[model samples]
Target: MKPLFMLLLTYLLCWQVSLGQQNSYTGNGQVTFSAGAPLDLIKGTSTAITGSINQVTGKVYFEIPVKSFQFANSLMEERFNNKYMKTDRHPKATFIGEVTSFSQNSKEVTAHGILSIHGVSKRRSIKGTLVKEGGKFILKSGFVVSTKDHHIESPKLTGGFMAEHINVNLHLQLIPENVTPQVATVYPAKKGLK
Candidate 1:
């Protein structure tokens, strides 16, 4: 499953190359999730994230390795990986989509795409803030994920300690792509370069 996410990312990069689009940015991001229950709260965070966005095309992609998420309690982490997420089998969660109604000057943007997790794929539209500062693009969003939708079964042994809905948060900071395609460029042709 991790290989599949890698393949998808590679394919997107190749697609960018094929389109001669260099006006892009790719970098490491962060993902955090929190869930509330009657007994206690569950929280985890992961920094092993990679994502990219094409400035000219409004395309976006993000990938998260399941095992990268860290929990405060080792036992919870183990149970999360072994019983809930099954990270050994399905190792990644990914999203690929296009930004709609986006602009560098706009404060809010939306990305509509498919979210694949736990071997289940669903169409999800995420709305977030888009901030451009010092030549970097920052995107942040918060959303909810239903465990049942992704086939992530909570342990009945918890005595209903887990919530059915998981709150997810994402943060990405990206800089413009420095490498440009040799044949076709993403940005418009400069004067006398045509």
Candidate 2:
């Protein structure tokens, strides 16, 4: 009887450790943004997205460097970093929030948190899908960002070449932090951003 009890205790301890490891994940991903006006469309893609998730606490955080985004036109890229986004002053955009609703049986998830861009922070609720496959979590989400909300000024001189709202997309695959994946990188937290 004592031997059986000891075996059960050992099993429970191992299970708890495994559960803790599975609860946290860190990874890199891709982000895309598109702004469409009546006459022109501006789009950019960046693969420098880094994020982490704590499943047990429902905490999620993501960061992307402003200068990392790439555009089809060099002029657009330069204007975005220097004139619009002011990458020299506001170097990164980040989202820090909690998963308000999540279910393992379902793929739908909602995260409520603060999104900071161009040194402006706003409360936002982003809806996305989470899928668990082969011990990794794949998160996909789409949302629109308002230029006014982030204090981004439109180029009036360009005759409405930029839209008021930009469409953003995210595709991320997060793996357990303990495991060393091919592209596992997490950005360090910045001061005053939390």
| Clash number for each model | 0, 0
Candidate lDDT (C-alpha), each:
0.84, 0.88
Model 2 per-residue lDDT at 126: 99
lDDT per residue for candidate 2 within 1-194, as digits (tens), equals: 54456666666766667667789999999999988764577788999999999988989999999999999899999999999999999999999999989876778999999999999999999999999889899999999999999999865535645478989999999998783223323344565664
- In model 1, where do residues sit more than 4 Å from their true spots? 1-22, 103-106, 155-162, 180-194
How does candidate 2 score on lDDT? 0.88
> How well is each residue in 69-128 modelled by candidate 1, as lDDT tens digits?
999899999999998999988999999999987655768899999999999999999899
Best by lDDT: 2
> TM-scores of the models, in the given order?
0.77, 0.80
Listed per candidate, the RMSD to the true structure in angstroms reads: 11.7, 11.6
Candidate No. with top TM-score: 2
